[model samples]
Target: MFATAARNFVEEVDHGGWLIPVSSLNDTVNLLSVVVKRKRFWIWQRPKYLPTDFHLNDILTGDTPIQPVSIETDFIKYDGTYGENMKGSVNANVFDHSSFNVEGKDSSKLQSSFGSLKKEELDVQKLLRDSKNRLLDMSHGLVQQTMEKHRQVFGIVKERIVTTQPCSVIEEVQQGGNCGGRLSFCGGKSPKVSLKENGSLRKDSDVTMEIPIHTTIAYALIELEIKHDGRFELCLLSDTKGGFEVDGPASNQLLGASRAPMSPSESSHLKEELEQLGEHFQVLSALPATTRASLLQHITKVMENKEAVSSLQQVLEQMCQGKRPVLEEVTATESHKKSIQAVLDLLEQCGQTESAQANQSTAVLAALHLITSAIDEMTHECYAVFWMCCSFTGLQTLKKLVHCVSENGELPLSSSGLATPTEDVYEKTEHLFASCQVSLKRDGDTVKTEIHQQPGHRPLVLCIAIKGLASLDQSD
Candidate 1:
């Protein structure tokens, strides 16, 4: 019985040992401060179970585990008053710190590698900054050069002078017809009369005393004579009691002194008118040799009037009448004639008003100036003188001139309808002349230009001359 009991007890003990509770055993082990060492095969197979700081050599050597040492750094403060306290304090514990645990040679290599990377980065930044600065400077210089070139180009354009050729040749015949037609003529016949000794008239001698008829026929004849003679001389007066007569001594004196020197005012006025005329019409300078002589005579007679207004009106009238037909023929448009007529009507209106303002006179002059310019343009003449003259008057005057020219469709233009100088046409013909000569002479404010067309195979040799004067002084 004892043997059987002992056997049961042994069997139960063996079973209890195999069936021990895992939770109770784990708790007992934890409470007893026991070290549960994992098997070497298990540690090698399960890398996750190995300590983070464990090395293969430590495991191979089976060395005792090293305890981590906590390093503390001591910082000492030094006051300026104590020389000995000024010395810096370094902790020996810093050498054993984990951050400083790298091998001495490897630490130096790492520091050098990091320093090289930083230096390269700084050099790259400096190079990039320098390149950017250089690019900016180059751009600034280019911009300045471009601006200077544009300024020079603009200045050259502003100073450039544009010239154009005449639109058409205005024949002297046209000028003469137009000028002569403006004058009135009378159809009165001079009756033959004989004076009786007894102051009694016989039937054959019967005649009535009548006032001499005012006739433009004589004026036309005189103009024709002057044109032919190339010298201004008074027309022979008829001895008949009633005959065509001219203005007395004053008119005769002006005609007689036609070739004589002119006063400064007269010369200046004539120069200005000639310049204005010449600038517009190349033909004005190309007129027959006698034309200038005739013009000088006519101008002298017109200037005999003391009133500047009347004299100016007379000059305008002569130009309008003389150039109207030629302009109309050239343009094939009546706008030119209408424009001149409008100006004439305005001038007449101004004349009627005793209190006409200076501006009214200026306006009339502007219109006349514009009409003359249009006429010159239609004739293929330079019109810049008109613009120059009108510019001094007023902007409104220039606008008026443009308006009139535009209305007439006579504004100088190229075949493409672009505004161009008239000189373009003349330039083409310049090669046709053998010895075309252009000469300019300046005296004080007056400039005289002469163009001589040398005798060639052509039927006619042309010589044109013009005199221009500066604007009258405002003080004058």
Candidate 2:
């Protein structure tokens, strides 16, 4: 009955769901004690038939609690790129309490017990061999799936290249006009045929195609550039009326037209008109101030009066009643040049004094404006003289003007920063003649500058030749 009771108690306590009985003994009856454990493998064993203090310190003192060290078990699989081990490693210590019986304290030898547990030491050699075979099979399947994904993307890129080349070929045929009225293959299609593959095309012939007559790579780049920056759009020519007509989802139309050259007859007529204008300007410049003002007023009045004969000649005739009816030829002599210089000097001297005074006096602003305008007129006459001299001598007279106006005040163009005598004016007009080609018309000794000229117009020898002439005239 005692054996039965002890066995039943041990069995009930050792039920793994809730408890565990680590160790036990039952022979004495004078002093009795029972110990039981709970789940998580915690042990609580006691000596039966003994006093409480007889073995109290042995069961409870000195390292009574032990914590298990951790271990990892990984069921890793391998791929073709690199193989990994299906690894399981133990790094733990065992808990024991045997020293409580003899030394009156709890003690453990977990490290040595864990090291000595070698049931699978021989079995690991066979495990290594088995892992390699399993990894190889996994690697082959992984590699096959990766290669299939690459093939699918490559197919898409190839299709785009094939579809795009034909658009260029169509443009080439239209521009060259060498298709012999037969459409050459644009990505393998007849040039005369246009097609829209968009879902909008309900019927086969409903496709729209237009060839670019003057195709340029710049036009293609413009279309591609906006795609990266913002929302991209296109419009069909048949749908939209004007500027935005050609922009659409997949429409191609060339954007710019080539410039047409002016014909010989049109060129001759323009030259004649320019020459007449030049003559009128020279007459106006040479006229006395009051006489010029009167002529302008008369012309304005005639227009206001709505006169039937309001031509410039008729207007001039009405203004010059008692004065010399026609202009008399005055040869451009040394005396003429000196007289012109003297008048220009008087005008500039007054102008510089007024310009200096303008900053100080708000009341003198209108007078300053009038003086500045006269200075501009004198400057224009100086340019006319310089250009006329060049025409007569066949020498480039503008070199001195360019040199004086240059930042360095030197003949040779240089990158070095240098100061000029007239720095303010020089900075503004230094590059004026570097781009323009001028042509002069010589009628007797008077040379007139014309805008329209023959193809033989000299390549930009120099444009404005008398830049520093105003400053010189002022000094004189």
Candidate 3:
């Protein structure tokens, strides 16, 4: 029974753990009968219940040889638990003690070096920020100074042209010899005028004046002559020869001869007319000599009388209206048309050259204004000089002038491709001719007459033209 119980206990323990019974099996079986059962019976039952290779002989006894469990002791305890017990002290010293001390010193040196490197990086950042701030401040100051200088220069230029009150010759004559019978002067200096009284009539009274060219005001001269019959002539002369002589007339009979005696009002009117004419010539002096000569010749042909002036004005007015002018009367003669065409071609070439060189629309507009003002002045003087002479050449010249202005305005002057001032000029010119209706017709004798319906309207074309010219004049 004892052997059987021992074998069962060993088998149960090998499979899992030994299980104890709650009730005693001593009353169910006889102990002697159990003992009689063979050990071979348990061996056979064990193979069926557990593994086939399991056996009683494989079971370990208390005297069987065993290997001990391994415990690593090559590390130090960092919790200050070393030497608290004999086992901990013995294990703590297992590692090299001097190697840890050397590692600690190296770690301290690395920490110190890292702290210094961070401080240097911070200092470099601060220097970069300061340099950036200083550079911005310098740029701002430079820009402000440049703007201030430009403002001062602009103010000085604006103040250069003095707009004096219009002077009257009658007023000057009344004021005595000191007045010199001179009108308003444009630049810093006035022209030198010498008058000689030949008789009671202003006719045969030789009046000689020296006008400096506006462009080269220091050297060039326009020797002016006033005839006995109130006719005025211009000769472009230079001081390069030391004495003023005939450089040739600006235009053929620039002002027509007047036969009648001048009344007080008429004298004042004539003086005013001549003064305005002088200003226009002054502006023209800025252009090339050839251009000036050609324009002057064309002007002389056109300014014969009121009919011619009216005809010319009508054609120009039509041009300003953005419509083609009817040139039947002016172009009736091929010679007249060819002459006028030549003048137009010359003016167009001049405009093109100027436009090509000009980088700004403002510059082109200023040139246009100057040219128009000169034309206006010439037209006015012509109208005042001869109210009787009738000529179609004047009308042709007017057409050419309008064509020149339009051509110059159409140039691609600005980078933006839009000219604001040129548009304004066109608008004003259109408005000037809106109410005036003009017609040209030949009478039974083939004498052409310019029929004008409205006479009181004043044109603003000249005013706008002068605005840009005046600026250019100041700059020059």
Best by TM-score: 3
Worst 10 residues of 3 by lDDT: 104-113
Q: How accurate locally is residue 313 in candidate 1, as Cα lDDT from 0 to 100?
A: 39
Kindly report which residue stretches of model 2 are placed more than 4 angstroms away from their true locations once superposed: 1-277, 291-421, 434-476
Clashes of each: 13, 11, 3
Q: In candidate 3, what are the lDDT values of residues 350-405, reduced to their tens digit?
A: 55774344433233323433343333333322223211111212222223222222
lDDT of each: 0.23, 0.22, 0.26
Tens-digit lDDT track for model 2 on 1-476?
Answer: 11222222233323212111111122111111111111110011111111122111122223332121222222111111111111111232223211111111111110100011100011223322322222111123322332233111000000000011112111000000011111122444544443322121111111122312211110000011011112222121212211111346533432211112232123343344333323323333433454334433332222111111112222223223323322223222232233333332433343365333432222122222222222222222232233334323222234333333222223332322322324333322322332232333323322233333332211111221132221121211
Clashes of 3: 3
- Better structure of 1 and 2 per TM-score: 1
Model 2's number of clashes is 11
Better of 1 and 3 by TM-score: 3
Candidate 1 lDDT for residue 66: 23
RMSD of 3: 58.4
* TM-scores for every candidate against the unseen true structure: 0.18, 0.14, 0.20
- Specify the highest-lDDT model's number: 3
Q: Which portions of model 1 show Cα errors greater than 4 Å?
A: 1-257, 260-337, 345-356, 362-476
Query: Order of all candidates by lDDT, from best down to worst?
Result: 3, 1, 2
